[model samples]
Target: MVVLPATLVPRLDFIPSKPHQRDGYEPEFRRGILFEIDLRTFLATLITVGSYVRIMISNLGRIGWAVVFAVLIALTIPWFLWGDGRVAYGLPVWLWWHIGWMIVVSLVFTLFANRAWGTGIEEGA
Candidate 1:
């Protein structure tokens, strides 16, 4: 079989230096305000929230149902107080408050799932 010459291959360094030089068009990223900060902060918050969830689940076996129920009720009832608050980050304060509450509820549900549902499958089964 005949082999092709190496000189025929295109070199990356020889390519146009700029986008406009290569294709006569410059592309824009168009990232909105707070894009970078928002992503970093969101990831950090998610990690912190996950740690809290793990702690909550670990403690579930010790806390009584009454305490859990009380906390659940207290969290739910606070929504009324959040109404008519000043806006933050383009969303009503109450909306952000509820979003935080939802995260707690989700962690509580995770605890319940682990304790009440037995983590789904057995090691041997």
Candidate 2:
């Protein structure tokens, strides 16, 4: 039997580089849209532009869109809202939050589809 040298062995301590990162094993990240500051501001602008754009394409304006976006951002984050060690419907409070959030998202999506959906594409294009 032949013994392999250690140089041929793969290192177990290797750290993987994450996507959108600039360098390997470094905290530096690539310049991307998400890396830009003012995430909340950006989200607000996006929602506003999207709503107006939809209005231009369709007669109906986006309704309860800001509320939906606010709720989605608020509920998706697990920091501010704690579980409180409470359980409901055989599920934790935090889990219930997500479930309710999903239901709200589904309803909002349906509403957008029926009333506010727009691709910003021209009729001929």
Candidate 3:
């Protein structure tokens, strides 16, 4: 009692290739299901996403550095109040402090990835 969409149902003109020869090999016309996909495209998409996850998880040092930066920023309080309640460069000093922290985090992560992660490739190869 299997049901399939109209588009997925095998058409009358569609013929399955035979690998071996038979006495009277008239192509069997059966109402069977056929599924097709480009192997290269499927594998490429799978590999790309898998590689991204692998690289992100493999870089333990980079993750640790980012976590430390985040925790430090969250716990620090003096910088938030050190701005003398004034604005600088059209933004509050506290806001600038946060912006600077973000920049530092980006730089540290980039450096760690470049020097320690090593492009997510194996060491020997």
Best by lDDT: 3
lDDT of 1 by residue, 15-124 (tens): 33222223665665222221222445656777999989876765564456447757877877565655486889998877787889888888988877676553324421
Highest-TM-score candidate: 2
Weakest 10 consecutive residues, lDDT, candidate 2? 28-37
For residues 1-125, could you state the per-residue lDDT of candidate 2 as single tens digits?
12223343333334332334355445553322222335466567789999887666453232355556676777675665574788888988888778887887888789767754552343311
**Weakest 10 consecutive residues of candidate 3 by summed lDDT:** 12-21
lDDT of model number 2? 0.56
Q: Over the stretch 1-125, how does candidate 3's per-residue lDDT look in tens digits? A: 23333365445345443332368665553334343335566467789989887766667555775677678667445454674778898988877777877787688678766766543355521
TM-score of each: 0.38, 0.40, 0.32
Q: How accurate is candidate 1 locally (lDDT)?
A: 0.57
| Candidate number with the higher TM-score (1 or 3) | 1
Give the candidate order by descending TM-score: 2, 1, 3
Model 1 CA lDDT for position 51: 86
Evaluate model 3: give its lDDT.
Answer: 0.59
Clashing pairs in 2: none
**Candidate 2 residue runs with Cα over 4 Å from true position:** 1-67, 119-125
